[model samples]
Target chain A: MVKAIDIPFGPQHPALEEPINFTFEVEEERVVDVKIRLGYIHRGIEKLAENRTYHQNVYLVERICGICSFAHTTCYTQAVEELLGVDIPERAKYIRTIFCEMERIQNHYLWLGFTAKAMGFETLFMYTWRDREAMLEVLEMISGKRVNYGMNTIGGVRRDITGKMVERMEERLNYLEERANYYKKVCTKERSILKRTVGVGMLEPSDALNLCAVGPTLRASGIPQDVRADEPYAAYGEIPFRVVTYDGCDVASRILVRIDEIIESVKMIRRALDGMPQGPIRVKVPKNVPKGEAVSLVEAPRGEDLHYLRSDGSDRPARLKVRAPTLANLPSLRKMLKGVNIADIPIVIAGIDPCLACMERVILVDTKSKKGQAWSGEELWRYANEWYRES
Target chain B: MAALNLNRIRRRLKGRVQEVFVQRERRIFIRVAEEDLRETVKTLIRLDGFNHLATITGVDIGPAIELIYHIIYKDAVVSLKVQVPKESPVLPTITDLIPGAVFYEREIQDLLGVKFEGNSSSSLFILPDGWPDGVHPLRKEWTLGRISKKVRRLW
Candidate 1:
């Protein structure tokens, strides 16, 4: 028998800028069961691909998200290029790699700032943004815009990073490294910061793997998976970097993992500069691509971003499907969120460093109790702390 | 990456486990050999460090519905596509094995009307109240109406 115990968390809440409604049944503020409902931002991007010309779809895919605009273009462009079987020029590869790293740095900085702001650490957020501005400036210099660089095209990238620009980026990144180190300490040593994050939201390695978590979220769970190091593309194969991993497998570990990755990306950019191959930035693509499917991926700041295209020997693709990392990662939240209080939901969710969208709501109900209310952050903390203390 | 021979990964896993293809030096496919998928996945996951299964891709591939696992062990990607016949498209869910594929499986089931065996529930992911039945817009057979049927975007 279903008694009335329905609770709505949000399609809009302070913890989220985007809308998602997670309604969970409370058993003394501990979420025993959860159901997630999300479709609020599904703009039918995949269907939108069916009508657009293959060349035009690159632009369409990039608009899927502002923060990850380049990721979309890169993955889409790579898929098309693969189908056409064209070799991207060495210099174009270098340039794409450079900008790709720039995107990673900027994204990590933004996520760092967001994580800080989510935790009420306004100063840390401000500091992170202050440091991030320099990277965005460099991105604007290369692509003529702060976000959505607009340089990706089928076969090759459209822009090149000049030596002078590389020097400029290096100078800024050096300073960013310094500031990132400072923030690293704040994230690790600060009681409030550590208290809110450290062990609060945890994903055991098994659950992380079971959920097929990606990017920093997976790496934080002691999984050393980084696409750049794994399936090197866009000059990634030519570059050198470590696959950053954290054994903590908690929100704090994720923070550390992202920080470590930003540092690595900075190094990758420098390596791209040191060994950038000079050549044409664009290459000829097939007027009519062969009827076949292609799948391509890139190490986006979030995680593995995938693009699949099935061309029909026409200018337009017969089918295109994009698998954003968050799609695989959402279920992993259950492993972290449950058995904890509600207040920690926002920041802990933030800790996954989620792409601005892809929030799902889980609904839970207790058969025995008719009363219902969703978990708040404070309640979440009390429950988590109580469990930890009691144990 | 050094260890990943995308060609070998593609060859080894092809037919035995799923639909396999190599594109621009990368290998990907869907897991069809349900019984061998875990072992195949374990090998890929161990070899190339394709440590993550990014997401699942589902398409209404005409006669049979397709579900692609899209695994990333290291940099090498091994996609597992399980084709289910339209009359009764049912593939065992790997969520218990790769928990990350849960939501993706859910999304695939919701949009394409393919049933994933072993999922605990199916309360509808993208559909809404009073949504008409047998009208999955993503199906190759279904075309988008001049005005889509009150489609609400999911965040």
Candidate 2:
């Protein structure tokens, strides 16, 4: 007889970088149902945005998520600029595009390393992290900061990419391209990676659409939806790039999608550098914005990051709403979690490339005992690694 | 392409909606009533291809709470806006139509006090577990100071 057991994984788990709770109902080895509770780290950023001026909110929104800081600031500034009825300079647009793609590269590299660690491939994790540092060095060189670039402003970018910076960035991109190709080969051919990721956490293409999955998660499931391709914000309209997609509809497919996206981002950055026009980096605007509202979308590393702004002819916004890509992808995560093994849970969660800070919260509950237990995410990670080793 | 989509949306939602206005290129706003919300969404999905519900933003006006359902069709964002009175603060849930709306609806319910009827889950989504009742932080009247004071009193 199969005994039904409720296993609570994380409000603090080793597998997750941030806190989130998932209570898994397991019938033997297979998961029967899963319940997610959030709000462990909700800081109320949306309510706070309405209280700050448009200029200050640029820095404020960047704090939403460290990995996708530029994505948030870019979306926020674009909405405010639209309300102000100002078109940023051409050079600034290209500069913004370069930074956006650079951010994608760094973010994908970080995720690649983190997922490798989750799967117990320590050597691969180390290799990816070493390669990722080069990308971060280039970012720090351009923006004077490693994590939150703070490159975006209301009118345009805060800084310019000089000829020297472009040359340095090109050298880094060439190096990153080689490392990306190496990872692509390993991800496709490595026996352990293939065994762990292939056919695991399967999400049907139809389910992915109906559940509203976005970014690489949607593309990996054979849909070619991307904000940059569809909406053509910033310099994307002028630059040429392909929307990467795969038919695997599994964890392996998600990995391939992000790796291919890194290659595409590198190429796009080079193209943006080549086609960059020489002009001012910013255009001045008045303090008070006009009475208007606008919605801006940015194709963040994870998915489509959206921002809605309503201005009431004041320096401060009437309302500000941010829909991080992770929030849109959570429903799909719930769909993916059903019917997977206990060992596969961590990788499946990591497969979404979730930025819980951008979204928020997690708690675990034991239904059998009718009580909640605190299990660190790291312990769950160790358990999965050990289970895979024993198997 | 966006213009064509806008015209089709305007024509399709002409009589059913209160008003339709284009904020700019690719940004379409339709002021809809609470009763017509489901029908309008169904028409957008089944007739036109606005299958993706980008997000729902709820704002607290003085007399009523305004809900904006930002739906994406191709390149354009066709927003369906609905207003419910503050006293009642209730509207039909669209979770049956789009399953992904469950989280967004719960978020609005927790922060703005606009109850989405039939949403199923009543758990606090983004707020702390022991948050005081009837205190919607997103409403304009609940300033930072008032919220802090209320929570301090509770503690």
Candidate 3:
């Protein structure tokens, strides 16, 4: 009988941040079964939201995952606004859409560079990261912060995009569009890169749906499902852009999907800027949200972010549930990892662009008692450090 | 189109459901007894083509645990909620209908004390190792300070 051995992958690694360990059961360098352990960064944000006021929870939710901070706050605030029955102004919707698309561009660029770096395409990684600075500069210009731009609140955005800001954004987007086109060519035609990515991590379209994958990971498999196109939050209802699906269903196709999406985001941002309605940016929302529950879904840069809010006629929420995209995409990652070479694990994972910090929760199962065990984050970190040192 | 399909499902499960209403535009909420939960979701899947399982959110109400299964049908999201008594928080698993529910089920079972009858990986998934037995942090009774103190004592 061929024996399968276990390879402990990570609570810490170079390909991504956030502590997630994958226990891969391998037979002759091929991964057969996978086990996952999480919770290295669990801050109990959902529990914390219950004690804080609605206004304070906005900033709290934004910190759930820095890469998708705006998406989290937008989703949370939209749910709160719905609970309060507050209607934000039209101009605020346009500005919100612009920021969302800009964040998408910045996020997609970061993923492209990271994936390329994983594949050892260092030059392309540097190029993508360098060009990515343009989008980050635009975000900072508008919101005055790079990562966690505290622009979103209950009724609308805290910042506005002026005509000069729009002009500067247009110039940068034009440049990004040009570079995106070039990256598209490089992704598709470059021989070495193609060899590493094409057909490396294959997830069938049906499997993607069955696994309930979200965002670009689902779109790359040719599902044509997007919350922005389907639900039409913010200015997406007025803006026109493609859903950007690729049927290749491989790591290479994921690259193509993200690059194409960058172009689409640029176009949508331009549309939102040019056709922006002139009006107030926010409306006055009541301090205490009415007793009600609201569900808000937004297409985050990574995937669809869902927020479920329940308020019991008080300033603080009764329960706040944030389902980040990576959480929805984790099962799909396990499915994609099956039957692949151990060497391909990094590229396969990088393709998902997992934000483990956003979805952190620890699981400790006592094998003898078959019961759950609680361990602190500090203890988990120490355990990981010891494991690393011993290995 | 979505509303009509939802209405048809609502009509089908008229007596089985506890309460059913459209929460807002493009969102629906269905509350069902614990026994009717899986069958209700299967009926919705068959009727409205609800193939996507958005998420399963578990909340601790005083005497029971509330499980909300957000299923996506076309453009609208339909939430199916089932409440199990806190003393024996056990419910049938719908992972057979939607394979993706397995992760969320495991998570709920971990954070809350709920048990799914047929879920395969209904083990600890999101909690840290050495967590105390019979202590659920997500429950209403478990205060933030209490959980921190418990963790500190363990450390």
Candidate 4:
């Protein structure tokens, strides 16, 4: 007889970077059902955005997720700029495109490292992160910051990619391309990696659509949809690149999709560098934005990052709504988690690159007692650890 | 083809909605009657190929709570807005059609006090546990001062 047991994975688990509590119902080695509890990191960024000026919210949104900080700022700034009806300069558009692709390189490397680390391939994790540092160095050279570039402003990019900076970025890109190719080979041919990820977490293309999966997660499931390709923004319309898709529709496919995307991002960045125009990077705009609602969508590393800003002819946004890719991809996570081994839970969750920081929001009330139970960080960690050992 | 798709969608829900128009480039806005919302959404998803429900954003617009369901179709985004009186904010859930909307609907229910009629899972997905009941933070009346005051009193 199979004895079913309830296992709480985390409010604070060793696997999760952010606090996402998952209570897994397991029978022997297979997961029967999974209940996810979020909100541990809910800072109410959307509500907070309503209180800050449009200019101030760029920095605020940039902090929503560390790995995709540049994506958030770009989306927010683009929405505000749309509201202002100011045309961004050609040079600025190319500069924004460069930063966006550079961000993709850094974010994909970070996810690759984290996923490898989750799967206990510590060597691969270290190597990927080491190469990731080279990408960050290039970002820091251009944006003056390693993490949140602060490159985006209302009208255009804040800084120009000087010729010297372009040369440095090119040097880094060549190194990154070589490393990416090596990683791709290891991902495709490595026996241990193939055994773990090949047929695991299989998601059909139709399932991906029903669950509204975005970015690489959706693309891996035999869908060629990408925001940059579908809806061209910045310099994407002018630049040349192909949307990468795989028919494998499994964890291995997801890994391969991102690896190929890194190659494509390198090509796009090189295109932006070669054809970059010369002009002022920014245009002066008024403090108060016109009364309108603007929707901006950018293909972030994980998925499509969307921002909806409603301005009431004031400096501050009347209402700001952020729909991060992770939120859209959570249902897909739940779908993938079902029937997987308890140990594979970490890689499956990390595969989605779940950014709970960006997905977190506000309000809770327990229906049974009319009062919710708040678990301390230490208590939740203990609960997660105890379940892992027992199950 | 994109224009025809939008036109077909607009045609299907033209009479059921209060107003509908292209808000901007690649954005179509439709303000629907509260009763006709679920039907309109079903038509869009089932018939119009608007498979992706990008997100459901709830805003406190003074008198009424406005819930906008941003649906993705190819390159365009169709935002279906439905307004409910703040006194009794309730709307039918679309989770049955688009499973991805469960989280967004729950978020609206938690933060804005807009009750999703058929959304089964009520355990708070967004806010931390022990938050005060009947006090929706996203409501306009629940200003920063009032919210802090309410939290202080609740504890």
Which numbered prediction scores highest in lDDT against the true structure?
2
Give candidate 4's error at residue B83 in angstroms.
1.0
lDDT of 2 by residue, A1-391 (tens): 6888999998886376788888899999999898887888788889889887787788779999989999999999999899888999999999989989999999999999989988999998899889999999998998888888879988999888888988888899999999999999999999999999999888898888778889999999999999998899899999999999999999999999999999999999989999999989999888799998899999999999999999999989999999999989989988888999999999999999988775422245788988877668787557645753453
Give the runs in model 3 whose Cα sits over 4 Å from its true position: A358-391, B1-5, B120-123
Expressed as tens digits, the lDDT of each residue in B1-155 for candidate 3 is 55535567668887887887887777888899899887788777776555599999999888989999988877678888999999989998888888887788888887888989898463568888888887788898889999989999998
DockQ of each: 0.58, 0.70, 0.67, 0.65
Q: Which 10-residue window in model 2 chain A sums to the lowest lDDT?
A: A356-365
CAPRI category for model 4: medium
TM-score of 3: 0.92
Interface RMSD of each: 1.7, 1.0, 1.0, 1.2
Candidate 4's error at A66, in angstroms?
A: 1.3
lDDT (Cα, 0-100) at A319 in candidate 4: 91
How do the predictions measure up, each by TM-score? 0.84, 0.92, 0.92, 0.92
Q: Tens digits of per-residue lDDT for model 1 on A1-391?
A: 3443545677675355776667766566565556677776777778878876776677677777777788888889888887887888888888888787888889899999988888889999898998899989988888877776678988788777777887788889899788778878888899998888878788988778767777898889997777777678888878878998889877899899989888888888888889986778888676578988877888788888888888889888888998777666778876787766667777877887766453212223566896566776677557645753453
**Superposed Cα deviation of residue A333, candidate 1 (Å):** 1.3
lDDT of 4 by residue, A1-391 (tens): 6899999888886366688888899999999888877788878788788887677687789889877988898898888888888889999999988888989999889889988988889999999999999999998887777887778888888887777887888889999999999999999999988888987877888889998999999999988888898789999999989999998988888899999989999999998889988888888888799999988899999999999889999888999999899988888988998999988888888888888774322234588889866767567557645753453
By lDDT, the candidates rank as: 2, 3, 4, 1
What residue pairs clash in candidate 4, if any at all? A363-B127
Q: For chain B alone, what TM-score does every candidate structure achieve against the true structure? A: 0.75, 0.91, 0.91, 0.89
